[model samples]
Target: MSAEIAEQPAAARRTLERLMPQRESLRELAQGRRRVLLAARGSSDNAAIYGRYLLEVVAEVPTALAAPSVATHYQANLDLSDTVVVSVSQSGSTAEIVQTQQWARACGAATVAITNVDGSPLAQSADVALVTQAGPEVAVPATKTYLTQMVALGVLADALSSGEALAGDLDQVPDAVSRLLQVDVAAAAEALAVADQVVVSGRGLLLGTALETALKMEETCLRPVRGYSYADLRHGPISVVSEGLLAVLVAAAHGPLAEPMADLVRDLHARGARVLGIGGTPTFAELCDLHLPGPDLSEAVEPIASIVPAQLMIEQMARRLGLDPDNPRGLSKVTQTEFAG
Candidate 1:
């Protein structure tokens, strides 16, 4: 699992190299599609959350995350004639995800499959297949595959946008990830490893990062961890914050969402939570009890790099807890959930 985590940079480069060339074609699909619906489960679903933001922000198109059960369980027949359904999965064979793609096509939506497997069911059946090129990820928990999926989604966002929204040829991401690998997250990991309560929060673009990070902790660290958007945290989850709680906040150094996140930091601190900041600027780092400063990148793609710190931290945290990430209890690399209907 550690090796798989370290391979993210290379995996991202491979994905970028393969997908960037298809920009025009993918953009053509974007130009014709009136809306988008993304489908996935588990880690891939978190990537879909990121994709939701990217497509809406960059393409100015209405986007939504699909509730596949609507079709699989209730068998609701709805028209998706003008929608583009982009389904993401590390292994394209996950039963429900593949069924979702098949159902979307049945609903008249143009389908796009983003998967690591070249010709898996989900990929072979889509109108366009954007294989992740992340190679075979043997770890029980997804690492390189997740990052590669994000890269592919970012490329799709660029394709959907009128101008270059992702920016910088997307080459900087791998280097940024490589640089973050050098950061010492042991202190933060050690601190959080023994904490009784942990919550991860990020607003806007990095919300998915928070969700994915929390999942990593939950799976590998064998603990109960919750992830919420800063906006939504106040709605319910914030009440649990108090002394001995460890909060990890994903914040950009400066952006529209930064102030609210900073405010969240202050609020968490007030409530006596020990806050660990991720990907914040040096100035913002002062607000955190412990901070792991991440690479400064553009808002559109910063999330790609923003997640690396937590990935590193969570892996270290898992090891600290004496849990083997490769053998995270009761988890398989690919989960298959087929509809019984």
Candidate 2:
């Protein structure tokens, strides 16, 4: 996992370069598509969450995350003729994901598969395939593949919107991620080592980062971690915040959502919850009990860069807890379900 995380900058560069030539295809696939639906599971589902925000906010398209069982098991037919349905899978063989892609194509929607394997069933079923090009990931926890998937989503966003601004920001991501991997997260790891439960919160695009971070902690550290957007947190989850609870807040430095995240940090601190802030702002750093500063970048591209330190902290916490992050108990690198067959 550590090696793969370290390889992210290079992997991101390769993924962006590979997707650049596919811009025309991406544009065509999204041409007349009025809405976007994403089908994925596990870590890829987290990537889809980011994709939802990107496509909706940047491309001005409505997006929905698909429940694969609805199509695969319930056999519910969807009117996706005017929608672009995207399947995101690492191996591209997850049965339900593949089934969803096939179902979408049959419904007259343009299907796009974002996967590492070019020859996988999901890739073959899609009208367009956007490969992450992260090479082979052997760790039970996805590091590089998850990061590269976000990069591919960024490229797709640019292609759909016909904008070069995000692409320019993405070009700098590799070096920024490389710099983040070098930062020592031992102190932050130690701070979270004794937590009985964790709550991760963010807003907008960074909510996906929060979700992935919580999953990483749960899988590797064997802790119960719940993630929510800042607004959702206040709805009911805020009542759970108290002493001995660990709260991780992700904030973008220069965005409308940044202030609310900072305010949430202060609120959590007042409630006696230990707050750890991850962002590129001085105010966020000062407000949290502990802070991990990320690379200065646009919020659109920050999701790929912000996740690095959180992954590092999870690795450190796993070691501190005497667990092997490479092979977490009761988990496999590639999960094949009954639907795949």
Candidate 3:
């Protein structure tokens, strides 16, 4: 897994940059679409939530996220016209999502496939394929692939909303990711070693990352976890904070809520929650046990940098707990919802 993550930067850049030239074509296909429907499961589904938000806020387009089962069984009468279905699948061959894509296409909607595999069933099936360059993911729970998917989809949303010029600026993302991967994990691990519970929070696209981080901590580190928005934390979530708990916040750089979110971090510090602010130029580096470096990309684009630190934190915490990340809790590499003999 270490070797896999090590080799990913080069491959990720190659795969992502290859799609830059085609941004105009994709944007052209997406322009003025009445509704964009995204479908997936697991971490891919979480990424799709952010994709829907980015499309709506950045592109000024209406979008919704649906589990494949919703369109396949629950709501068969879904409107198909002027709708583009973007299916995100790491394998590009998930039975349920593939089945859903087929259903959407049959209903006359244009389909776009976003995946890690180029020649996989999803790419072969869609009207256009947007491939992520995350390389091979040996671990069952996605890490880098999830980050790349967010990057590809966020840039796609920008292109679809504005123009090709926006995508050219996107080539700098790999460099930002590289910097983030170099963040000091030693400090973060030491902090986590003593923490009893961890609170993860973010706004907009980063919100899903907070959830993903919470899941990683629960599954790998055996840590108590909860996730919420930066603003929502003040409502009631912060009441549980103590000297033994860690508060991790993802503050976006380009979002309207960015500053207030930072202010919330400061407030958390005053209230005694040890806050580790993940995004943007953090004001209190010495106060934060761990400070990750990042580029000031759009709010939708901040996930790439924010996710790596969470991955490192989980990996280190797992090692501390004496658990093998490759196979957690005797869980198999793959699981199914149904099987046919």
Poorest stretch of ten by lDDT in candidate 2: 332-341
- How far is 44's C-alpha from truth in model 1 (Å)? 0.5
* Error in Å for residue 84 of model 1: 0.3
**Which predicted model would earn the best lDDT?**
2
Model 2, 1-341: lDDT tens per residue?
88888889899999999988898998877877788899999899999999999888887678989988888888777788899898999999987888888888877889989999989998887889998989999788999999999998888888887444477888889999989988889988998898767899887988899999999998988888898988899999899889989898888887777766777777888898988888847878888888898877887888889999999999999999999998899888677666343
Q: By summed lDDT, which 10 consecutive residues of candidate 1 come out lowest? A: 332-341
lDDT of 2 at 124: 83
Report every candidate's CA lDDT.
0.86, 0.87, 0.73
Clashes in model 2: which pairs?
95-340
lDDT tens readout by residue for model 3, 1-341: 34444554565587677776667777677665677899888778778877877788778778988667776667587668788899998889877888889988887788898899889889898988888887778886677777777777866776677533346445666777677667677677667767877888877767777777776677666666887876687788778776767887766666576666656766777777787767655554444656655455655566655677778767876777787765577344334445646
**Candidate 1: pairs in clash:** none
Candidate numbers, best TM-score first, in rank order: 2, 1, 3
Q: Write the per-residue lDDT of candidate 1 for residues 161-217, one digit (tens) a residue.
A: 876567584778999889988899999999998898999998787889999999988
TM-score of each: 0.96, 0.97, 0.88
Clashes of each: 0, 1, 0
Candidate 2 has a TM-score of 0.97
Which scores higher on lDDT, 2 or 3? 2
